[model samples]
Target: TFKYVDTDHDGVMVKGELAAVFDYLDVDHDGKLSYAEYTKYDGASAESQLTHDVFNHFDTNKDGFLQRTEYVDTLFSQMDHNGDGQVTRHDYDHFFTNVVHHEMHQGHNGR
Candidate 1:
């Protein structure tokens, strides 16, 4: 999935690549991602509601919208577990397997 997201094949996820990802998730082509857009990956089920809450957690500015900068920064920070300032495939895998799973579990538990 990391390689898939790295459309530029640049070994690291740059802001532009991350923006493209956000655009894909936005669905509506709007500049910001609403809860519906953010949670659309799993359809309009309960899981999507949980995912929406997770998206809100990423909205650090509390603006009720996910700006490109916020999405990129949150993704990079989560994936860059080693603090190397780069999100390699290894980091992405680690993040997807560990952080995402943990977050999902927490969400399921209503944390």
Candidate 2:
């Protein structure tokens, strides 16, 4: 699941990873995930864990919404592919492409 979802293998998750999950779960592409996608993919485990993990990490100040720092820092790390601490759109697209490929393989592998 991590391999399929982690995209660039940077040991963390970014928008690409989240978008992959969302795309899988948001079959209707309504810009949000719903129960239908969960059941469709048999992703109960991933859904539950994703919910829990998101709450634990993004809620750094225990606030409901993510702060700018938390959101940027979390996604910025992997987006900075060169480790220079700045992220360009290329980094994002590259990671996203990997995410899509990985997900395709996972679906083919039946896990």
Candidate 3:
């Protein structure tokens, strides 16, 4: 998956990697994500308040759609820790490790 993120094979990650993610997620390739495209679950997912909250969290532009930059920038905020616009492997590892660690220590094991 790192290779997928490292599209340039340069060992560093820029917003382009996240751009690819946005593209893959843009089911219709319309350059933006609709509510359904973003939270595709059962018939009620798109109408759920939690889904709306999550979608609005990433729709920073308040445009009712998830723009590519909006999606990428939202994630990049956590990945690009040094403000250099590039996420090294270390950054990737640290980010996920912390995420996993948080979940692991959140009191639930495996249900």
Candidate 4:
């Protein structure tokens, strides 16, 4: 999943590489995502509230659009749970499986 998100193959996930994921989520192809568009993203699933919160957290500029840097930073921060500046497989899996899944299930009621 990390490889897929890191579209640039730059050996590290950067703002540019994260644009691929943003593009995928921006279903309207408007170059920016509104709250409605974000909710519709496939990754959103039943965790619409958490997804919404995540989006807001990443919209650092507060312009209601998630710029590339914000998106990349948000994802990297989440993946690097220990704040050790490196995302180990254990950290990645913990965030992916536990954090994301927990949020998703919370919204879906264990759908």
TM-score of 4: 0.50
List candidate 1 stretches off by more than 4 Å: 23-30, 39-50, 61-63
Off by over 4 Å in 4: 1-17, 27-31, 43-47, 81-89, 96-111
From the highest TM-score down, the ranking of the candidates is 1, 3, 4, 2
- lDDT by residue (1-111, candidate 1, tens digit) is 677678889888665677777889887777778866765643545365546666776888999888877787777777777777667887788876878778878877995
* Runs off by more than 4 Å, candidate 3: 32-67, 100-111
Residues 1-111 of candidate 4: C-alpha lDDT, one tens digit per residue: 666655655545544555677778777777777776666655455455666656765687899887655666777777777677666556667887898777666746845
Q: What is the TM-score (0 to 1) of candidate 1?
A: 0.65
> What TM-score would each prediction reach against the true structure?
0.65, 0.34, 0.57, 0.50
Error of 1 at 35 (Å): 3.0
* Cα lDDT, model 3, residue 57: 60
Model 2: lowest-lDDT 10 consecutive positions: 31-40
Inter-residue clash pairs, candidate 2: none
In candidate 1, the residue pairs with backbone N, CA or C atoms under 3 Å apart (3 or more residues apart, or in different chains) clash, namely: none
